[model samples]
Target: MRDIPVLFNNKDECCGCAACYSICPQRAITMSEDEMGFEYPIIDKTKCVCCSICIKTCPVKINAL
Candidate 1:
C-alpha cells in the first residue's frame, strides 16, 4: 500500500461535495457524516490506488498547493 495523499487537511476546506466519492474508481472514498450532520469524505487507504482522481475531483483540493 502507498501513502495516500490527503486531499483536505482542514475540515472547513471541504465543501461537502461528493465528487471525490462519486469519482473513485477503486471505491476507496466513502462519505461519512460529521457531528454537524454534514457529510465528508473518508478515504480507505487500503483500497485506494493513489490514482489522484479523488484529488482532482475535489473542488477544494484543486486550490490546494
Candidate 2:
C-alpha cells in the first residue's frame, strides 16, 4: 500500500464536486455532508489503491494549472 495524498487540506480548497468520488476505480471515495450541509469526499484507505485518480479528477486541481 502507498501513502495517498489528502484530497483537500481545507474545506475551502474543495468545491463540493463529486468528480473525485465518481472517478475512484476502487470505489473508495464517499461523500459526506458537513455541519453546514456541504458535501466532501471521504477516502476509505482500506479500499483505496492510491491510484490518485480522485486527485486527478478534482476540478480545483485542474483549474489550478
Candidate 3:
C-alpha cells in the first residue's frame, strides 16, 4: 500500500494491544515507542499491502461500533 494501513486521529484511540502486529500476514506491523514511551503499531510501508485487517481487529474501532 502507498500509505500506512492504520491511522488514528488521536493517541487515545490506540491501546497498544498489538492485535494489528500479531495478525499482520506480512509481518509488516511493528510495535514502536513514542517520545513519551507509549508503544504503538508502526507499519512498514514496504511490506504492507494496504490490508485493512488491522482496522478490523482494532479494539478502538470495534468498541466504537
Candidate 4:
C-alpha cells in the first residue's frame, strides 16, 4: 500500500488525545508540542508501516458529530 505524506490536514483539527500515538504499533507517531504547548501527533514516515492505524484512531475524525 502507498504511504501518506502527512496525517492531519489542520493542526487545530487534532484534539491532542494521543489515540493515534498509542495505537501506532510501529511507534511511528510521536507527540510533539506546538507553539501553544499542546501536543500533537507527528508521523515518522520512515518508521511508518502504512498500516493506517493512526488515521483510524484519530478521535477528532471519529468523534465528529
- Say which candidate scores most in TM-score: 2
Cα lDDT, all candidates: 0.85, 0.90, 0.84, 0.81
Candidate 3 achieves a global lDDT of 0.84
Candidate 2 lDDT tens digits, 1-65: 66886999999889998999998999999999999999999999789988888988898988877
lDDT of 4 by residue, 1-65 (tens): 77753557897788888988998899988999989999988888789888887887777777664
Better of 3 and 4 by lDDT: 3
Which ten-residue region of model 1 has the weakest summed lDDT?
Answer: 1-10
Better of 1 and 2 by lDDT: 2
Better of 2 and 4 by TM-score: 2
Pairs clashing within candidate 3: none
* Tens-digit lDDT track of model 1 for 2-56: 5686878788889998999999999898899988999989999779888888887
* lDDT, residue 28, candidate 2: 92
Work out how many backbone clashes candidate 3 has: 0
Name the candidate that leads on lDDT.
2
Q: Is candidate 2 or 3 superior in TM-score?
A: 2
Look at candidate 3 and tell me the lDDT of residue 29. 88
TM-score of 1: 0.86
lDDT of 3 by residue, 1-65 (tens): 24556546788889988998899999998899999998999888889888788888898999988
How high is each candidate's TM-score?
0.86, 0.91, 0.84, 0.84
